[model samples]
Target chain A: MTKKVLVLPGDGIGPEIVGQATRVLDALIENHGLDVTYESALVGGSSYDAHETPLTDEVLAQAKDADAILLGAVGGPKWEQYDISVRPEKALLKLRSELELFGNLRPAILYKQLADASSLKPELVSDLDVLIVRELTGGIYFGQPRGIRTLENGERQGYNTYVYSESEVERIAHVAFKAAMLRDKRVCSVDKANVLEATELWREVMDRVSKEYPEVELTHMYVDNAAMQLVRAPKQFDVMVTGNMFGDILSDCAAMLTGSIGMLPSASLDANGKGMYEPIHGSAPDIAGQNKANPLATILSVSMLLRHSFGEAELADKIDQAVSTVLDQGLRTADIHTDGDKLVSTTEMGDAVLAALA
Target chain B: MTKKVLVLPGDGIGPEIVGQATRVLDALIENHGLDVTYESALVGGSSYDAHETPLTDEVLAQAKDADAILLGAVGGPKWEQYDISVRPEKALLKLRSELELFGNLRPAILYKQLADASSLKPELVSDLDVLIVRELTGGIYFGQPRGIRTLENGERQGYNTYVYSESEVERIAHVAFKAAMLRDKRVCSVDKANVLEATELWREVMDRVSKEYPEVELTHMYVDNAAMQLVRAPKQFDVMVTGNMFGDILSDCAAMLTGSIGMLPSASLDANGKGMYEPIHGSAPDIAGQNKANPLATILSVSMLLRHSFGEAELADKIDQAVSTVLDQGLRTADIHTDGDKLVSTTEMGDAVLAALA
Candidate 1:
């Protein structure tokens, strides 16, 4: 039962949140009979400041050796002027590429306690759970010939390729279909098949993969229509699968569904069973030391890591129920606060979840 | 002061809603001393059923000859299985490509009375006005090498190109800047500049364009973050510009900000002086003949066409004021109905707007 975890608490509030998640990990070991080993490394702005590089080979090697990697948020306004190759955000790109973590699972769930925090109607935002399976490592974002070039007449054109091989489509489709089998047993593969050849190939591959999962009902939607439908009626969707670029944008939009950004977590998985779990939010440099930044997203990431990567389903459920219990008890973080609500600091909120777990 | 207008009630609820808009236009000519001419033509599924082509040469000729074009919604399930070359959606694409309508302006405004239809908080969705100026002619949607091709390895890889020439970026930037100057004087250029070269060029061109209009505060946002911000804090934006595909997707997401889908309208302006106006919603075939579809969006499009293309500023303002007056009268379309709310049918709602105008 020994499990090795690499923690990359990149910058800003990362260390504080990771510190709390580590404490919860220790509790799992002490009380739940789970054997755990933990290691910490610097990345993003922290790594850039320390070693003049966002990601060093030594840290990358450690990350590869670990069974799972948990990331605190990365990048800040201070690192915004850095060169693209050495930018703090590039550290994430490098980690994702090097690990070949092709499947990004972002679950947008509306917790009952934070329903009022949503811009959406309470009835629409309440008890809604959606999983977005974004094919992370391929398509337009990484395709070749992707730069500015001068034409013969001194004019310039910027170009990027959107290319998808069958293997790329097949592997990601398999991930999405497998995820659908575990959820509501319905999968909607979103693409601009009518317009883009890449999406057509993606759709064909998805169709081929879907046959293996006969229990899941499959549907297709164009990206534009999907965007409209997401607002028009999001309740119709169960599990949505799409390519890297589309997923990156849509997943962010979908996160807004739950009203508060502090309640969401994401997991990116690779072939041969390695996974990276992290909060979808970034380093809030403005609130770095104020204890005002919400830690619930990071806590939820830890819960996802426990269940998804470690296969500790019961422990995962316990963490989730603890989060619900804390909210129900009216322990509000600043981000989810309302009139007459009890507002707690970051550490206090973390402590409340821990207490609820007991 | 004679002006000619072309009306293409494409399909589904196209004729139903466009008919109401035409009545408004007729009223403008008869009651307001505005000289106007209306011409009808075929496009979308209706044309496909009659002529075996969505946009025939005759229809294209009519669109080209007219001073302005008013398009109702296009496409439906009946035409969903058609070939890519002759599909109903292709008709709209062909018109844009043929007309070189490069700047698409999608205005998302939540009417005071219809605020309850939105999933967002009423206060957040009310009195909102944001315009997304999407570049229409270039980028992924119409870029070269955009179809399925065979690879040498006997496997197929789907391919699409996202190319943005300097002039292309410059023209669209000009459109957005000019539009912003007419509004609240802030412009955000959205792109994946960190990842794609075309977006880098797009950002660069926008940077140069911003220098020309020192009065407008120009900002840059990565498309992913921008997507999230659109939902997180939509009020912070005034005018947003991006490439064709990103515009297509993000504009729809932005439209959801108003919570009233049927109340939004759009304009696609070709800088050389021609433009097309339409409701952002599609042909709801299910509600096609039921007198339940909302016509406010179409009526609003006419207002936009008058102001933006025809330069009838006072006339446009009058139309907007009239629409607002009707909403204030508690006249609700079925789509905007709440429990115990007074509701009116499509024609009756149009009558209310006309009454307010009088």
Candidate 2:
């Protein structure tokens, strides 16, 4: 009984980097006797080109049945001309909507090997690891009555709602609290409660959720102060749960704390335990098919998929160790290749990681 | 006829710092023959204690009738225990609602003397100045249908609608464009149009607004990307305009880029050009009445009031030069007293700045 996994090698450098990840997946299945089946599908700009649509029903059907989905970077300059609904980036929004992927897990881990990559002092960046559990399905991103309207006076108005139901906040709060229970047993809920009525309710829901996890320490911080603290002392955070827009902005800031887009991976999860894993970086259409794409992020996405979706914690640890080992050995892709001696092509870097695993 | 000005020196070191600014304002009137009138008031915990309300009707009336208002700071641990609506922070929010202050101007300027205060390298922070024109009145802050409600399933729901009519966006766009014309003549309109519908309208309105400022180079960026870029290369930005929430967050980030919070000042303007000036830093309750508080921010606030509301550009420049001269003379307050041998008390620092004017 092989566990079915869907690999969506999306637009731009998506295929190139995911190709390397797939090689590692195959190696895992062969060496570890893991029961797994990999299925490849086109998404984003590639899907738009193949079928004249960003995401077709045929692909969605395949995706719904898979145990977990691993997506590479999506969108490129080629699809920027498309209408909003059919744009390559729309594919990602569509997938998340259809799949009900509500929980977004963005881990900001500062690898010791790339300490020089960060803008902060080496002492501040080293040994920094914090998990941000962002509520994705609700909040401003999908709030209703959102759009542009042409007024009677010939003025165009733009508006978006920041709406959150109790269940919405409660469900995500549980995700963060449960995550904290597994890790450092601390959860800091970030919101603009003092200014936002929605966030006030968000705080209330978080208060109720915290009662369920008495063992976990819960703290609250305003989003602006949280932004400052992230730069001031990132290591102070354990697991932070926040709304969609703040989550999106802060997660990107957290990623920069790691110093390179080539090192971060994210996970979007739903209530049924199903998950979608992807790297935080976008498709570098400029360097597509050149074997110059950084594959470490995609490989880390696979690592997240194993631990978060399949419950293979040991296997996930091995993959993470392999990445660290490769870095320690001075193998680097173009993005992380600071010193000339550490330079390695995408495939060679991927191979080094695999060899490190051995 | 002398113009009336109300000074609300609320909690922490507010009173001590604001005292210096008021003294400077008096000196301008006495020595420079400027017509002015001033009244000092309390509006935070101190107000709650003496006047029984954070902002009494008498204080509100004075603020309404005054040509300009200068606020020192508000909120402290003493007021955090009050109910959310009645908290010290709400006093500030209530004033904004009453005054109809629609445009918030925060200028991030790295003074040559304090360039080393920034986390970034001196080269990155030196001579960097950016004006963030944030819409203060509209968007999520005052939008309708906001708060918590009970659903059919007996579950509580919380929501906030972020509504912006075309006219609202137009007003803020005009503010940004006009400010850009006065400065570097470029504006980057930031929103999340790709995902949020409200932002789509925001973008559309900006598109229409751009036609009016044909000479101004207009560009659009998602808020998340804008936050990253602000940290990456803040010097590249001239003027940035965005919705209330994004502006609130981004301006704070920009403020920290120069690394000295005590040197920053902000101005909120109304439709009729009535303005309120305030320092970006809150009341430091820890240092209150200790003569250790920084008066530079309060002085800077007066500078903004002179330039934005009174149209006294030369007077504003003189005030700015005085503060810069004080910095060059190695006068540092407690919070920013990192530079050895430059530390000076609140009154002494004010005297140094005023003497620099001579």
Q: TM-score of chain A for each candidate?
A: 0.95, 0.95
lDDT tens digits, residues A1-358, model 2? 6788999999889998999899889889999776789899999889999998888999899889998999998898898898988888887888788999999999999889888777766677787889999999888887887777777888766767788888899889988987788689999999999879889999988998999999999999998888877866788999999999999998888888778888899999887667899999989989998999999999999998888888787888899999999988888888888855478888998889889776
**Highest DockQ among the candidates is held by which one?**
1
Question: What is the docking quality class of candidate 1?
Answer: medium
The number of clashing residue pairs in each candidate reads 3, 1
What residue pairs are clashing in model 1? A119-B120, A120-B119, B118-B259
How far residue A226's Cα lies from its native spot in candidate 2, in Å, is 1.8
State candidate 1's TM-score: 0.93
Model 1: per-residue Cα lDDT over A232-314, one tens digit each: 56778899999999998888878887788778889998875578999988888888878877777878887888777787778
TM-score (2 decimals) of chain A in model 2: 0.95
- List RMSD in Å for every model shown: 2.7, 2.7
> CA lDDT of B356 in candidate 2?
79
Q: TM-scores of all models?
A: 0.93, 0.93
